[model samples]
Target chain A: MATNITYHPSPVTPTVRSSLRRQQGLTIWLTGLSASGKSTIAVALEQALLRKPYNLSAYRLDGDNIRFGLNKDLGFSPKDREENIRRIAEVAKLFADSCTIAITSFISPYRADRDLARQLHHAERPGGEPGVPFVEIWIDVPVEVAEKRDPKGLYKKAREGKIPEFTGISAPYEEPLKPEIHIRSDQTSVEDSVKIIVGYLEEKGYLSAPPEVNEV
Target chain B: MATNITYHPSPVTPTVRSSLRRQQGLTIWLTGLSASGKSTIAVALEQALLRKPYNLSAYRLDGDNIRFGLNKDLGFSPKDREENIRRIAEVAKLFADSCTIAITSFISPYRADRDLARQLHHAERPGGEPGVPFVEIWIDVPVEVAEKRDPKGLYKKAREGKIPEFTGISAPYEEPLKPEIHIRSDQTSVEDSVKIIVGYLEEKGYLSAPPEVNEV
Candidate 1:
């Protein structure tokens, strides 16, 4: 229990918070094998979202960016990986609560963990069925293709036994069965992938509506 | 190890990110005895900031809200408390990265834990001495006063031995020697406390400046 915690009234429900931001809190979860173009697409998507006429402030939380800071204490063990994803999901939910679009680029090669994240973000409101939008984008790329396009030579390092339990090389990579969006990262350009995502957000009304003229 | 993890260039710096929001990413860390009016003051401060012209989107991370979500697995043990504060600081830093005013209301009774938070937020920037603006606000209140004002029955529970290791009752509350803002919650009005904070932000350049006439 919190030592000095006083249970005050819950200020501003998620609905009210979202209304203030004029946008829905969203999590675009990008998962695939390493070097699968997730982060690249995420970077472009952030810029694209900012260019749009929405109040949405897009924030990308990628594996590299997070590893050096939030999850620096964690290692690559199975338990640690689970904890890492859990923490990241929690932070994404926080951003969602604030009505910000959080893009997470992680090689979360586990089915159950991804489902757990979906459950966390898909929590329902008082009368609603689904709560926040959790768009799981599977950046599908074959191991051969990813290894060939390895930007950091980590695949080479894994093959040389310099790294251990490297996903798709030593550890297993679980593919998603019913992902919200399936991007063939090996085939699709980064720009096209971002277009598909931004278009989906627009079609789904996650982006803010145009301001009304003195509706009050 | 992260599979094929590569050192990618940073997409945006903190300066550039804050420019987009038209505000600085600030963390107001509130620490005090339980029932010391920390959450109340934080709530009022957030509302006050939103009413301003700056693009400051204020978000609060209280112990109650975060306990069930991010730190649900954590307990109230000494070690768990440290982990809890560490994770909260990391999330607050993430919010700061996005240029939001993140107000953390916790009964962080340990000086070491709070100092760790300060260090995490005070990491040096490239070619700079320090990075983010971490404003530690000490919500000081006497144990007698806080016990009298306990809206909930927590103090009574602690008194009756229903709760163990309760700060100011069983455990010690290590007060900060030097904090950015020291609010005597027992004596000051909630409105006045917020005014002191907002005034400090204006003087410290956390709030946005006036709009320029012809600057691209």
Candidate 2:
């Protein structure tokens, strides 16, 4: 048994944590309309990253977890919606700071909201530590396609005027002008979608352990 | 090189996640007055868990992260304090649900707030999945000792009437009636405090990988 536990007196910055864990932290922010397969692709992507070759610590933040837990007090009002995205972004940054890959899937209709999320990830820390990587993935699908494939009937409710202020129906979705990766869910299989996202992560060196920390 | 990524269609419950990660998720909630050595002990315990013999994934949530990031909008008002604790508890639960050891160090004086944090961790999921484990550790220290050792001079400010509604001065601290682990920080060394907490976790089998998930 190793009895000597080293004391780390300095604050744990992202750099120190990356070196300690032998991995860099990043967030895969998936934005799309309802039924655009954001959650499906997120699930597959999380599984891919957690399994054999990657063996990374990855977790997902989607409606299932966020809507019922952290943001349950929030509603569809514009202010509430912004607060919802804000809290999610903060939590995702926290996960990334902990050296875990955070995957967030949400409609996140407003460009300002998504930009705020991106800015939160890119902001410098108090000790001058670099910000975590934020990868915006646009899961694109026509509103018609999304409504046709409404698995939970959310789009149907939106179209029927039962759910007010719904995106892609009564409201707007400001598309990402420069997303890191864009996938047309209508034209891509779930497996291929995961491949595209994972490939982008690998090519950008986000999937592997950081080179400087590898020797540790 | 491993291209075959398993598809996990079902919703990922705590059981499924524990099985996949070969570890159970848990939260070690540490409550004490400011300068009671809560943060010091938390940092050491986190290092101990992440290093050689334990090799577990652990993360700390404290004022440095929460106060400035997630709960930045909050102030020192009574309502803001309660909201602060609520958000921290929710985020800690999310980390635990992701199979990470969440260590929260806060001067959470109100027993109701701490109880709400415990309740969030103990409530059953929507699908009947068992709640994640919550360990309430009380770092006990005399108010006079804490005041004397105030590293940030917060106690001095409170006593001088510069900081109103300060805990253990203008406000109150409701001690835990039945904390899982209690340490008198005034008497114990930082290393021994960690040992005592970790020993409790080990004895309760919280440190070991779940038997059912060990072979995965």
For residue A83, model 2's alpha carbon misses the true position, in angstroms, by 0.8
User: What are the candidates' interface root-mean-square deviations?
Assistant: 3.1, 12.6
Candidate 2: how close is chain B to the reference, as a TM-score?
A: 0.92
Q: Fnat per model, in the order given?
A: 0.32, 0.16
Query: What does the i-RMS of model 2 come to?
Result: 12.6
Which runs of model 1 end up more than 4 angstroms from their true locations? A1-7, A52-55, A125-130, A210-216, B1-6, B52-55, B126-130, B209-216
Clashing pairs in model 1, backbone N/Cα/C closer than 3 A: A4-B34
Question: Candidate 1 on B1-216: residue-level lDDT in tens?
Answer: 344345555545555555555567779999999889998998888777754354357799987668878888888888998899998898888887777789999999999999998888888753353567899999999999999997877889999998888889999999999999999997899999998999999898788732422221
Q: Please, what is the whole-model Cα lDDT of each candidate in the order they appear?
A: 0.81, 0.85
Chain A TM per candidate, in order of listing: 0.90, 0.92
lDDT of 2 by residue, B65-180 (tens): 77777788787778988888998999999999999999999889999999999999999865678888899999999999999998888889889998888889999999999999
Residue A171, model 2: lDDT of 93
What tier of docking accuracy does candidate 2 attain? incorrect
